[model samples]
Target: MKSTLNKTDEVNGTIVIELEKADYQENVDKSLNQFRQRANIPGFRQGKVPKSLIQKLYGKAVKADEINKIVTDEVGNFIRDNKLKILGEPLPDNSDEKLVDLENDEILKFYFDVALTPEFDLPLDKSVELTCHKVLLEENLLDEQMDAYKKNYGTYLSVEDEAKDTDLIKGTLTELSDSEDKDNLQVIENAILMPSYIKDEEIKSSFTGSKAGDKVVFNPKKAYDNNEAEIASLLQTTKDKVKNIDSDFSLEIKEVTRYQEAEMNQELFDRVLGEGVVTTEEEFRTRIKSELEKQFKPNADHLFIHEARDIIVEKMKEVKFPDEFLKRWLLETGENRTSEQVEDDYPKILEDLKFHIAKQKIAEENNISVEFADIEALAAEVAKAQFAQYGMTNLPADVLQNYTKSMLEKEETVQNLYDKATEDKIIDWLKENVTVIEKEISSKEFNDLMNERTRLQEEN
Candidate 1:
């Protein structure tokens, strides 16, 4: 067998594989004998089936299969031996019209088309300048975060006085009707209500200064502006059922519960930052500032990387790709994707592909590699960020490690983590090589900058 690559252009090529009968005749004969041993004929025993009969029956199919295997192996070997940087898998040349005639031909030829990656020069040095925004943690921002912690660690108290807008009011809700007969009306016992959620002003005012044992009559549908989900929850029924009821409901108030914010004391600190983590308010504030910085680091890194990508991509404006071949390859490989859809998304796909190629080239030049430990560490950081979203910021190291371990057990999760870890390493390398100007800005300014960038991206 002989396999050779003919370059049609810089980024496109065709590999022709010529095979002789000797290459697959032995495998074909061996398969025929196996089939002969397994055959059950009418006039002959299984092992005694005639070789000629077996050859005639399965020869073409066996020969085609053997030739296909040989072609695939040869193509793979040729690509590896030549160190070709191919874009996608090689496809059968759609323009090639030659058909394999296993019964008549002793030598067969096959054509496969390959798209090679275009090579370009990447200028990676201090010449590339990027701005890194350092978001300043203002005093007011710290106070706001402290207030959130206070609210999260607050206590609920049952009050016996007026029902405030923010108070949780427990009552028995009974539907009122004009008819003297009230037996068929819906009644939800122990129904919880929040006066603040009432959409209608007059209906909400009726609950003002409402104390225990007071009965307030109002239309549930009208009070919430006919919100199906809210009415359903208050009436303890489905949204469909809530639509049928439009009568006034009498709520016999049982108790009013108010959420009281925790005082800025040692106990509050312990609850927010874990046991004995901070003893005084000064220490607590200092620790909170540190935690905020840690939380903001990822965001800052993301912004830096985003800007770095644009800078690097702008420098690579002259890079090229095998556009026509890739379009055909995409149309063939994509599941149930139409040409119109591929055309619509191809530009974005091409841009992403270019960035990917650039990143790979950078990694190759720097000898940057990701290990299991790198992935594990990034996974742990991810786990911490997830838990921090729910105010569980100070989770134990062992707990975070276990969560990360559980996440890495899934193959898809490991792959995703690996990709993220690799990108992070690349970003670090860029930060070291490129000229990064760090500017400390207020949180609001930083947010506005990010929002402006996002708006510009969306417009583009």
Candidate 2:
């Protein structure tokens, strides 16, 4: 068997494989002999069937299979040995091959079309400019974070004053009727309501100054904007029965509960920052500010990376690609993708492909790589962030390690983390090479920048 790569252009080529009868005849004969040994014809005993009969029955099929296997293996070996940088798998060129007389043909020929990777130069230097926006921890932002923590650890307290919008009101609901007959009135005990959640302003205002044992008459359906769910819950009935409740209901206020934020004391500090991390209010605030700075660094780095990518893309805008070949590849390989869909999505796909190629080239030139240890570290960080969302920041080392290990056991998770690590390494390399101008801005300004970026992307 012999294979040769014929270059059609810098980005396209054809691989021609030539197979002589000697290349496949031996394997075909060996397969036929094996088939004869396993033959189960009724007229012949096992291992006693004639070779001539077996050859006549399966000769062409066996020969074709052997030739295909040889051609495939030779094509792959040729590509690998030559260090060919191809885009997608080689596709068979059926148009170049004619019907062969397998019974008498001594040499078989096959053709395959391939797309080669395009080459370009992207040199990273101080010429590339980027801005890294450092988000300053504004007092408002810190106060907001502190307030959230206090609310999470807050307690509910009973009050004897009038019901406020933020207060939870408990009462007994008694349906009122104009007629003297009050035996069939609907009575609901321990009904709960919050003025803040009331849909009607008039009804909500009526409960503002109502203290304990004060009775306020209001229509449940109107107060909740005729919502069946809310009315049913307040009246202790199903949605189907809420429609029958048309009379006004009197709510006798039993108790008003107000939520009070946890005090800035030793216990609060211990619960929030882990035991003994902070002893006083000043220390707690300082530690929280420090934590905010640490958290904000990643956001600044993310923006820096985003800006760097844009600069790279704009610089490499003139790089060429095999447009027709890639479109064909996408249509053929993508599952259930129509030509119209591929055409519509090709621009974005091409942009992403260009960035991917650029990243590969940069990694190769810089000797940057993602190791197993890097992925493990990233996985551990991810687990810590997830746990921290639920206020479990100070976890045991073994617990975090076990969670990270479980995540790495999943193939999809490992692949995702590996990709993230690779991108992160490349970003680090970019930061080292490019000119990054660091500017400190307030949190609101940083948020505005991010929001504007998102808005522009959505518009495009």
Candidate 3:
């Protein structure tokens, strides 16, 4: 067997592998012998087929199979031996068709097109500065959050007074105009309406003083601020028909409901935080601050990563890629869409791929590793947060373990955890070793910057 690579350009190369009869004759013979042992033929007992008969029947197939195996092995070996970081799997060169005749040749020659990875370096030591915002929780923000919490745990009570803007009113909605042509003027019973949605200033004001059993006639469309769906729902009509029908409807109030806010005490804090976690208001506030900080850390880290990527890209602008070779390689890969489509997305793809390779190299240099335990712990944390979102704060140990195990068992979830763990390790290494200048910015400003960055990314 003989193998050689011809470099056509910086990124493009052709690897030719030549296999003589000696390279595959042994495997061919072995395959024929194995076939003979398993052959079933007329006039022959089982496992007693003659070698000559087996060769006549299966020689061509055995030879072809052996050649294919040899070719695949040699291709892989050539790549490894050359230490080539390829973009994708090698494709059979168009020129390979003329190189060898499978019917008569004792030697097989295979040609493949290769795309080499572009060489690049990290720009970590470059003078690049990025602001990392430490979000300071304001008193107003806490109070607003506390109010939301109180409302979430609030008590709903039935009242005899008229519905106010903050009140929920239960009424029987009836349509006055009933014509065979106006099927949309059908009435609905036991519909609940929030007074906040009522549009007419006079009608909204009138609702505050009227008691139960009072019949109020108002335009459904106007009352619901011209919300066609809401009007249709109140008048029992489809949205399309609601526009054609007259908007007048009668609302017979049956009940009025009001909500009383929950008292913030030790019990509330215990339920929000872990049981026995906070015994005082100060402790509760501190816990809230801690939670806010914990949440802010990832956002801050993301901003830093973004700034670092910009810095790296700016410094490494001189690094060049063999775009033509890459485009050809993508066309041959047969994974994504057409080459034109891939080329359209190539800029971002190339940037991400380059950064990923750089990070991997940095990780290797620093001997940074993400442990299986770290991944498992991250998975568990994710599972805990998902449970917490559903108000399941105190999950049993067995239940939590089962949920985490199930999450880790999913192929996508496992890959996500692996990626997160690897990225975290890489980022930690970068933060510790790289010259990062930390500048403070307000939370609102940081959020605006993040939103702007996201908008630009989406546009790209």
Candidate 4:
């Protein structure tokens, strides 16, 4: 068998596979023999069918299968042997070939179209400069975090004073009678409500400053803005049942629970920062500022990578791609798009494709790789970050392990974790070799910069 690649240019080519009769004749015979052993005929026992009769019965089908196998193997071998950098999977050649005369000809030929990766020079040195911002923890941000930690660790205390908006009110809700019969009222015992969460300001204020045993009448539908879940929970009924409830209900306050921030003592310190991490209030505040700074690293790294990508894309704008082949590929590969639609969407696709090409080249040049452990570690990190978003920091290791394990069980999640791990490793390497200019900026300024960046992208 002889196979060869005919290239029109750097980004387009055709692979021609020529298969000799000898290459497939043996397999055809083996297949025929197997068929003969399994054949059931009217006047012949199994395994007693003659080879000539078998060939006559199944010769063309066996020949076609053998030729297909040979052509596929030959095409693949040619690509691997030549180390061809391909853009997408090879497609059947556009021009149809008439079938080879299987009975007389001793050779069969097949043709396939292929797209090659665009050639471009990659720079992985200090020449690529990026400005990275150091987010300074402002006083208000730190204070907010401190307040959150204190409140999150706080306990609810029963108060005899009037109920505030932030206080949790425990009460019994009863449907008020429209007529003079008070005995016909429907009641729910031990209902819970927080005045601050009530949607209507007028209704929320009515409950505010109400002491124990104080009864307030309000329409449940208006108080919660017709929120089905809230109304159902308030009346201890199902959402389906809430649809018909349009009456005013009386909520008699049974108990008012006020939440107070935890004191900055040794126990609070131990709980917030782990045991013995900090001893005093000053130490705790300082450590919190530092922790906030560390927490912002992922955001900073994201911006840095974006900066590098913008620079790289601008520098490689003149590089050419195989427009014809790419357009054809977009139309194929299970995408339900017309040629015109593909043309309209091709620019954005090309931009991302160019960046991916650059990233892959850098990874290949540096021998960067992602192992299973890398994926697992990234999963754990992501789980922790999500937990921290909810202010549940420093979770037990076993709990994190369980989350990571569950995440890896999903195919999509595993793919995302793999991508995140690869990006992190590549960025880490880039920071060491690239020129990263660090500049301190306030959180507000950083946010404004991000907003401006987003605006510019939208305009483009």
lDDT of 1 by residue, 1-460 (tens): 8888899989999999998988888988988889999999899998998899988888778878877888899999999999989998899975536766667777788888999999899897898888877777889988998998889889889998798998998989888888999789888889998899999999898887898899999998899999999999898888998778889899999989999999999889887788999899999999987777677777788788878777767877777789888999999999999999889989878877888989999899999999999988888888987888777877887898889889999999999999888888998898899898998988778778778878987986
Q: Which one wins on TM-score?
A: 4
lDDT for each candidate structure: 0.87, 0.85, 0.76, 0.86
A best-first ranking of the candidates according to their lDDT comes to 1, 4, 2, 3
Instruction: Estimate, for each residue in 97-177, the C-alpha lDDT of model 2 and write its tens digit.
Output: 554556776777788889888888887799888897777889987898788878888998999877788898888988999
The predicted structure with the larger lDDT, 2 or 3, is 2
What's the CA RMSD for each of the models?
5.4, 5.8, 7.5, 5.0
Error of 1 at 229 (Å): 13
Please list all clashing residue pairs in model 3, or write none if there are none.
none
Tell me how far the alpha carbon of residue 152 in candidate 1 is from the true structure, in angstroms, after superposition: 1.3
Q: After superposition, which runs of candidate 4 have C-alpha atoms over 4 Å from their true positions?
A: 29-62, 96-104, 118-120, 160-256, 317-320, 458-460
lDDT of 4: 0.86
Q: Which tens-of-lDDT digit does each residue in 125-157 have in candidate 4?
A: 888788888999899998999899998999988
| Per-residue lDDT value at 108 in model 3 | 76
**Residue pairs of candidate 4 with colliding backbone atoms:** none
Model 3 clash count equals 0
Single out the weakest 10-residue window by summed lDDT for candidate 2. Answer: 94-103
Clashing residue pairs in candidate 2, if any? none
